[model samples]
Every structure is written in structure tokens, then in C-alpha cells.
Target: MWFSALSALWLAATAWAAVDRGEDGNIRSIALRTHTLKQPYLDSDMSSRWYDFGGDTVIRTDSYIRLSSDRPSQNGWLFSRVPLTATNWEIEVEFKISGKNQLYGDGFAMWLTKERGQLGPVFGHTNNFEGLGIFVDTYKNNRPGTVFPYVMAMVGDGKTPYNKDNDGKETEFAGCSARGIRNANIPTKLRLTYFQDKSLKLELQYKTEDEWLLCFETNEPPTIPSVTYLGFSAETGELSDNHDIISIDAKNLYTTAGSSTPSKKTPGRGGASKLAKQKEGGSWTWFFFKIIFFILAIGGGYVGWTAYRTNQKRSHRF
Candidate 1:
């Protein structure tokens, strides 16, 4: 019986050791949230400090970033300066496309690449139409007169043309059904998750006041192992539309064969200190285990005393 109890304890310890706790520990840095287009750009107005491109190409209106098109190849982008070296991570954002008379352009994209700083919409769409364009295509292109906007991901290394005449061979990643939500009607949330084991997952949910629905999902994984930078981008040609990005939060996990560590980066938001507080909540499990050990110790002591009493009575009788 004692041997079995010892074996159970050893198994429990082994199981506990295998659990992943990458998000624990102190944070390295936390940036104050700021709108990408705040006037005067005061430190207090900074909610999410975005790496804004096009200067006045974007505006904060009605609780989102509005990217407008005033030129032939107008583009807007915001990215964190942090390096995402972790093997596994999650990136999510809330986006809404509004306004009318928008045509012939790629929508918004969340990208992870080694290239530093901003790469404009020309680098985004290959041959002026395709490259790595995770396009929330608002206007009809391949399918004409379709009210449903399609979600597509375009990918290529470069070797492509830069004109509408060339339909570049950029790989299309995912798409959504465009029946329910109109282009200017409702907001949607898009989430992309990369696992350490080379599995990439994508999910899109329609935003609501209470909850979001998992409208689309995919199991296709990323070919690359490590991505240096992560950010969002949008482009408009003749027809103009705006993508209002509400929030973006990411949790990066550093893992090897033996150990794992998690670091979180939330752009334009604050929550790192709260995560530290939650780490303390995990200690209750250890306390519960200690209590169980104490109870077992007391029970063993009682059993030993009972055995001693029995031996003493037998000896006395003899």
C-alpha cells in the first residue's frame, strides 16, 4: 500500500512538470495605449502607440482607425517595434470596413515577416494586385455583383509583377461567406494563432456587444519557423474604404523540447500587470497538495500508533 501511494505521488509530480506556463513571470516592457492619429500626440492621449504610415492617411473616428485613400496607392499600417522571436504565438484584432464607392484594392492584413520598418501597399499586393495580401476584398473582382465580401490571404516572396495586368501567383490562404454582414454594416474580429509544433490556425468572428462568433476557421500551418515583426496594413486604389482597428493582443511562447516560456504583447492596451496577479492564483494548487500531504501524514501517524498498541497488548498477554 505504501509503495502504491509513493508511485501515485511520483506520477502526479511528473504530470505537473509537463504543464506549460509560458505566460508567467515579469513583463519586460509595457507601452501606453494610444490612437495612431492623435493630434499633438500627447502622452496621455496615447492609447496604442502605432507605427503609423502616411501620417494623415488615418484618423480616429467613432472608436476606430479610419484609413482613407487620397492618392493612387495610399496605404496605412501600424506595427509594434517588439521582436516576436517566440515559436508559438497568437495575434488577434477587431476590424470594420466602412464607407461606400470603394473599389479594386486589398483590404486589411495581419502580417509576420523578417523585414523591418514599414513596407507599403505596393509590397503587399503583387504586380499591383497580389503578393502577401490577406485581402478583405470589399469590391467585386473575380466574382462580380456578389454582395458578400471575401476574406483572402495572398503570399509570395517577391518574384512577381506590380500591375493590375498581371494576376500574380500569390497564394490565397482563406475566405469567408459574404451573405449576412454587409461591407459597411457590421464589425468583425479576425484571429490568427501559431503553435510551436508548426500548426497555424485562423479564426474569424463577427463582433457583438456581448460575444463574438467563430464564423470561419482553418487548420493550415505556416511554412516559416520564426517571424521578426508583426503588424496590420490596408490599401485603396481609386475607390476608398476604411478599416478601423480597435485592439490587438498577442501572447508569444518560447519553447524548446524541454521547457516553455510565454511573453505577452498588447498594442494600444494595458494588462501585463494583471497577468502577473493571475500567476499568484496558480499557487492554490500547491497549497491544496500540501494539505493533502499533511492529512496523509496524520493518517499514517495514527495507523502507526494503532499498530504499536496492538503489539503492546499482545506482548503483555504473552
Candidate 2:
């Protein structure tokens, strides 16, 4: 019995120690390949198994995906063919926006919507979308006193149209000004993290290398549905800029397996509320303690087994 218990504890401890951890000892989240996009973006057949790029979008096998060039009246987009079913996930996008003209109008958007491959008025994509839209607006339209290059988030209920006239002021709920996002020398990046019916956060990496600045994080985020497609779109008007997406990497948070996600919620009649839940604050102290206790159990079992063997030998001699 002692030997069996010690053997089991030793195996359990070995498995626990083998988990992947960073130099800082933090556990890395699992990557979801279905939603992740990176180099060698397309297959040899000149097509992606997971994505579809359309309109003015040009795929450069050697480098980035040019969503829209520095020309007027250009609109382009890239969308994932399958829905991102992960309930808690983080998506990081590396991109660049550059133009020759001193004045640049229009901008790009990142979307998680129920529908995909639709072209409409809102940021060159379809209006009345059923999920989240993160608009990176470079041009200042209306709303005096606010800064340009604003990053705003809006949740649509599939009925309300985006307020394009004044730059979506009516529908936007959370946002912040990101002035240095355009024309950056270093690699510019944006990270969007969402927990379904929970929190949502956006971070920017435009100023320096590997330094992420929080654009927005909310505990009471607008309710986002569990199933949604990931997509990116950009538009260029009279004043144009080159909207290039270098890469996209998406990862799942919490437990790796998608089976642990919360059940999908049916959308309300014509509105998505602003009462999202936040991930419960906790720590892994108990997990660490469990490993420690198992190690101690193994040691105790070995000691007991040795004593039992000695007693049996002495008894046999007597």
C-alpha cells in the first residue's frame, strides 16, 4: 500500500512539474489555431484554409495583407470562415497605417460579428452588425473637443444602424484616443481580449517594443454572444492611407479546451445590455499547495515503507 501510494504521488508530481511555464513562472494560455493567423499565411494553392480576403484586399506572400492601399475610394476586408467559439479569448493584431498625404481620412475596424463577408456603409463593412466592433478612427468627423485617432467599441443588436455621420458617437460605449497609432516606425499592434458575458479589454503597442498600453478595460462590458466570426476591414476616402495587417494571433484564456465555455445566450429583442460579468478574481495558491502536499505524501510513504520492511526482517529473524 505504501509503495503504491508513493508511486502515484510521484507520477502526479512529475505531471504537475512538466506544465509549460515562462521564465517568470507564469503559465501561458493555450493558442487556438482556428482563429490564429500568422506567417506562411496561405497555402501553396494561394488560398487560406481558414480565412477569406476580399474586395481591394491584396495578399503579399512575402509580407503583410494589404487591406487597403493609399488610394481613394478603396475598401477591403479579411474574415475568418469559421466562428470563434472560445468563450474567453485574446486576439493580437500587428498592423501598420501609413500614407503620403499629410491629411488622412477614414480608418479601419476589427469585428466579432454573427455574420461575415458583408460590405456596407459602416467602416466599409456592413451596418447593424450583431456583435462587437472596435473602430480605429484616424479622421476627426464631428464631436468637437475630442481627439482624433480614437478607438471606440460599439455593440449592435442587429437592428440599430451605426452612426456613421458623426463617427458612431451614438452607439459607442467604450473608447479612448490613440493618437500615435498611425505612422509608427516600430511594429504597431492591438490586442483585444474578451470574456463572453464578462469583461473586455483592448491594449495598444505602438510607442515602443513589447510595451502594451491599455486602451480600455471594463468589468461592465457590453454583453457579447458566445459564437462570432473574427474579421478585419478598412476604408480609404479622399485622403487615403495604407492599411496593412502584418499578422493576427488569437489565444484562448482560462482552461485550454473549448468545452468549458459558458452556454450560449440568446440575444435580446433589439438591445444588448451593459451588465457583463467580470472573471472572478482568484489565484493558483491552492494548486501550488496541492503539489507540495503530494510531494510530502511521497516522502512520508517512503519512510513508512522502510520502517515496515525493517520490522518484518527483525520479526523473521526472531
lDDT leader: 2
Tens-place lDDT per residue, model 2, 199-239, is 78899998998999988887667877778999999998888
TM-score of each: 0.56, 0.75
Please provide, for model 1 over 173-281, each residue's C-alpha lDDT reduced to its tens digit, 9 standing for 90 to 100.
Answer: 5555544333534556666666554455556666444354443344444354254556566676666566656666665544444333332334744475555446554
Give me the runs in candidate 1 sitting further than 4 Å from their true place: 1-52, 59-62, 69-73, 101-106, 116-133, 143-148, 160-170, 179-187, 207-220, 253-318
Error (Å) of candidate 2 at residue 197 is 2.9
Cα TM-score of candidate 2: 0.75
Return model 2's CA RMSD, one decimal.
8.0
**Model 1's lDDT to the true fold?**
0.52
For every model shown, the clashing-pair count is: 16, 0
